[model samples]
Target: MEQFPILLGAGIVLLFVFWFGFLSLKMKMPNVILYILLGIILAKWISHHEILHFASEIGIVILFFLLGLEFKLKRLGGIARKIWPAGLLDVFLNLGVVTFIGIWYGLDPFYAFLLGGVAYATSSSITAKLLGDTGRMANRESEFILGILIFEDLVAPIVVAIIIGLSTGEPMTLFDSGILVIKIFGITVAAIILGKTVFKKFDQFLNKIHDEDFKIALFIGIALSYGGLALWLGLSEVLGAFLAGMMLSDVERIERVEQTVHPIQNLVLPIFFVYFGTTIQFVNGVPMLPLLAILVFWSIAGKMLVGIIGGKLYGLSPRVSFRAGLSLCSRGEFSVIIASIATGVFKIFSGIYIVLLALIGMLLFTRAPQMTNKLFGKPVKKKKGLKVPGS
Candidate 1:
């Protein structure tokens, strides 16, 4: 048969995604893993398709942008202050320890660090979706989980930049690293200033406008442009997109704005996962099975430790902390981005690692509350008015 027209092909892909999404809802499974599996199955047909890649980028940027919409500068400051210690613990366990393991396994230091970077981040997309889908957004542990994800977002870009530099044999100097830090700081400050000044009055102006088209265009433009700016500055687009959303959080009717952008984000975001799956190439059978086993074990354990210890430090109860840890073991987009840096055996290794851990993480996340319940039992409720001998 002649090839389907591009538009028609795109429509078919969306239908498949919608079907998978529906199945996920019915089965109570996270749609993320399903979309990824779809990508892997369809990789032969769709691998490296430019349009899919671009759409995926748009989806993720908007996802982070929407996430940013939830936080204003003041609230963000509070979260940062409370979450830093746990964030530091996360860094040490996932990145620091994993890198050490890599070196011990006989890989060069650079390769080892790549391994660490792959292990360092939890899948923000997966975690966020699970939180929303599982109705865990209102759970006690959600705040801690989100805080850790945000911390990883801030750190991963710098790690990526450093990795890129090292991979190219032009490793970043201390001065260069300082410059990157400054760029991140500058962008953050600029977003804050814009939110406080320009967008502070945006609600009144938005109310004055009647065109939904213009409103969405403005929202998406800000997200993509900021994300693009981060790329230009040698940082992560997710960071820029997040800052873009935060810049608009000062607007009074932000929910209405989100209502406009959320559909578009949902539509494109599945493509991101599917595209990710397509990028996984397994030319040879899994390389270094023993090493893969070790890294996989550590990936889950490291994140669990971060969640449990960090949660305690953040003032959560032990039960809540354990649940938080269980939900964090899945590594997603950041892992994929870092893994793309590898070639040959390492690339295949990272691919398998990401897919396996993502599946396990999703399963654990779905079962976290139950798992915690088994360990701690349900929190006992006190009898009301049953009361007191004194009474």
Candidate 2:
């Protein structure tokens, strides 16, 4: 009851956040930048930590769950296996190189690992949006782009899980690593099996419910519950939310689930961005500018270079390859998620890096098509009615 004022203030913050996003969209600016900007402004407001933490946590869970709904089990396996080489290269360039750079800067090994994970994944939401805006979805290089984005979505959870496990105050041992692996494997396999057998019937039951609102509520409950259960099982709840999405992917029409849930996701995900922004107090002791510059470079160059290599392996031209690589430059949700969960230097570094990366990625996305056309006339083939869902 005493927290009522804080809740009111938070609602006001969300209104401004929504307006800022709307304005940014009109200007073709990434909303993440606006969220971060608003968050920084809110920093001076002095809000309670718990409410923000809870909203932001649920926001992230819903985000990953929605992200999972985008890919089906069958399509993902086919894509990942075909693009393994490029996916492997993306890991090396973005993650591995950035980690080595972190080490070279004299940070601890653990921080370096965090930095690598921070650099490794591209922002699926932004990339997909940009492609739609630019009319490049069916472009020759887009298949590769989609493939890599899917790959990142897959890799991010495992990396976050490991980082969380090792970064805790307690020292990690071989026994702990074994326990982590078993937990991940056991839960994931069990979820899949149950989803197909037990949950299939349950999903059919959900589909039979005539009340749309109730069905939507039930789906949201299932997603969040699995995430909570995963947390209790000593694994990353993000992974659980993702697995939950995958489990229901086949049984339900993703289109309906997404339509029902996207509004909820919209309301919450930005809170994470804002909550993260408020925590960014770069003060006297932090090496703010230097790390920002390096990570900005690391985030862009690594993705671009790896993207080029991936494009080449996929038999694209040098022009197409460069465009493909450049297209992957933006780092969004996962990078921010990594920062939010961490503390001290790691947190600060990730926040600065992602903001810079997002800005740079946005700038590059504008130029990828035009630049590719300049390099080779008509980089994209004639549009032949390719439909990317949720694009």
Candidate 3:
């Protein structure tokens, strides 16, 4: 508990950062990048002391849980046909491309596979922000992108589970992956049942309290309880949080929950981003120009191909599809999580520093709307009687 002061101070600083950072966003910049930069600077000033690691981890867990809450299983079900095809193609194709590159870089087959998997996921946070920023949340193109992202988010944990099983070297096979899936399904069903039975009643009881503070405490209790259960079940904590959120999504108290949680989310989520920057070692005194160039090119091109194929399959116009692919190419927090798993848990991979550098480079280049527009051009406007791609 000696570290409590540092943790508390960090939380306060994060709140300030988020407040100012969001203000910066209104001036046409990304708060995410700003938060990351703040984290990096703080770490450098302190020489990378483990000051914010614990708080940052909590932030990530909560962020993932909130992600799950926003899952909208029903909405995803509506677009399953288009989403599944595009998502599968996106993941596999991106995997194949990255795997080949990994092999070319002299990584072994196992490491190559891990690298490919890491590269396959799109950044859900970034996608959400982009859609909101462009006012395209309701557009067809936006729907396609969102569907693909949501599908990726749902499937990512399964892939992570498979990678974890394989890394353990305990007879990972098709049967094992299947069994893992079954277990996850079982856990989901149990969570839904228990949540519906016990949590619904508890939440109702809390609703009768009529005190805002008590209601907020009840909301946190529910999120933490479900999130804890998920971790205990060997599932991602985010999955549990998501399930909890979904259960409460249609509740009358959802608006209150959102309001009470908003400040906490704003404070913690940025720490996750900043800690991401601090974790990057920037080894060998920063990557040289040649290696950086190759990584950036491949990262961009790999996603471009996935986007094009996805767009074509969805019968979108060539331009719209190309833009969609370009827009989806940027890898953010999810990629970092994959890299950490590769380096820390798997031990089968060695080029994690390089991957991290590559991802950061990609993030630096792709974290803005202007870069996206420069790459894909602005959405085409259609005549009054015609349909626009996003419209």
The Cα local distance difference test for each model comes to 0.91, 0.76, 0.63
Candidate 3 per-residue C-alpha lDDT over 1-391 given as tens digits, one digit per residue, 9 for 90 to 100 = 4534655666666676767687867867656656655655665543344556655655655554554455445654576676777887877676777778778877667767777776777666655655554565665567677678767766777777766766787647888677767766876777567656665665576567787887667666677787778767666666666677766654554556677776666666666667766655444444234433565577667666666778778767766666676667656555666666665423322234334433463354344345556776876776687767897
Best candidate, lDDT: 1
Predict model 1's lDDT versus the native: 0.91
Model 2, position 299: C-alpha lDDT score: 75
lDDT of 2 by residue, 327-364 (tens): 89988777866777778766776766776677688778
Candidate 1 stretches with Cα past 4 Å from truth are: 1-5, 382-391
lDDT of 1 by residue, 19-131 (tens): 99999889777899899999999888888887888999999999989989988899899989999999999999999999999999999999999999999999998898889
Question: Which candidate ranks first by TM-score, i.e. highest?
Answer: 1
- RMSD each, Å: 2.0, 5.7, 5.6
How would the candidate models be sorted by lDDT, starting from the highest? 1, 2, 3
